[model samples]
Target: MDVSKPPFGDDDAHLRETTVSSQTVYQGHFLQLKRDEIALPDGGRAAREYVIHPGAVMIVAVLPDGRLVMERQYRYPVRQTMIEFPAGKLDAGEGGLACAQRELHEETGYRARRWARAGVMHPVIGYATEVIEIWFADELTLEQRHLDEGEFLDVFAASQDQLEAWMQAGQLTDAKTIVGMMWLQRWRAGHCQFDWQTVD
Candidate 1:
């Protein structure tokens, strides 16, 4: 999908997407980049570097009994196996909810009965276009799990204590996971509202 403009119904237009140029920072594992680009509406283009990433999708899958389904995976860069929510990158032109449903099935062998867009967060705003959509996935039932060939990970359904332990033990450090958890928290606490606003 095009990060050149925020998704339709994104009311916040704090930053305009100017024309850009990207340089590869790491071409292995996950794609990483450094972008030096123009700043729209400013009339003067400055060299602002960010990771030119095809933003990803994730799920906060809630089980029938209200338990959350998460995962444990070894991240080579971080050199640790962290417990994280099910997530993956978007296929070109793929909708974010589709990616979320697909990933939840692939990683945990579960499909959701109800789906809603929770919110989005830029994982690394200082240097990335990696705006990940953290969805609220509910009414889940077990399905067949089909892992991708290159993915090395484990499937785990965790309780609140278990999740807190993992976080305390230095796992669950992925930026997207943290934001997803917070998104869930805020929504449950009645602190959030999801709406789409078209860009001009």
Candidate 2:
């Protein structure tokens, strides 16, 4: 399948809303959205479900030597240590750019003089509409890093070749890390064709 092309066409029928459902389930971090079953073009009632989320932000930090600055931390939910870009869910009224700046500083002890939007992605569109906005942070300087309670992570810089080796060998599994690094790499190479496809 071509990644550049979206499978479904953008048509009125594609977004056709037939039945409405009032049922809702809230779970703090996410909400379950349910719509009443409706008849499809084939004369069948299709069940539709979607998870609502507040979205998220992440940052890809780059040093002068084309090295990637990333984090290694133990994720509580996954119960494993993983590598990822500095990231977090947006606080109430917090903008994506601001969240990226704050998270990068807090997690990596690095501050960027310039920042750019990397890309926004849908991790799991089949269930959750959890879109994540990524940013690129450059012209960095090390600052006082303030870690939250129970938050433990290591920050380091590595060549993309090294990261790719680690990834191919099953070392790095975090989605944000992979996405940020890929986008940043493309951006630096001047090969990105769209603004939403890469930062700056």
Best of the candidates, lDDT: 2
Q: Across residues 109-188, which tens digit of lDDT does each residue of candidate 1 receive?
A: 98887787877888787877788887887777787899988887888777655666666786666777777767766776
lDDT of 2 by residue, 52-169 (tens): 7788998877898878787888888889998777887777788898788788888888988877786799888877878899887778889989888878899888888988888899
Error of 2 at 117 (Å): 0.9
In order, the Cα lDDT scores of the candidates are 0.76, 0.78
Q: Which candidate should be chosen as best, given TM-score against the real structure?
A: 2
State how far residue 146 of model 2 sits from its true place (Å). 1.6
Q: What is the Cα-based lDDT of residue 79 in candidate 2?
A: 93
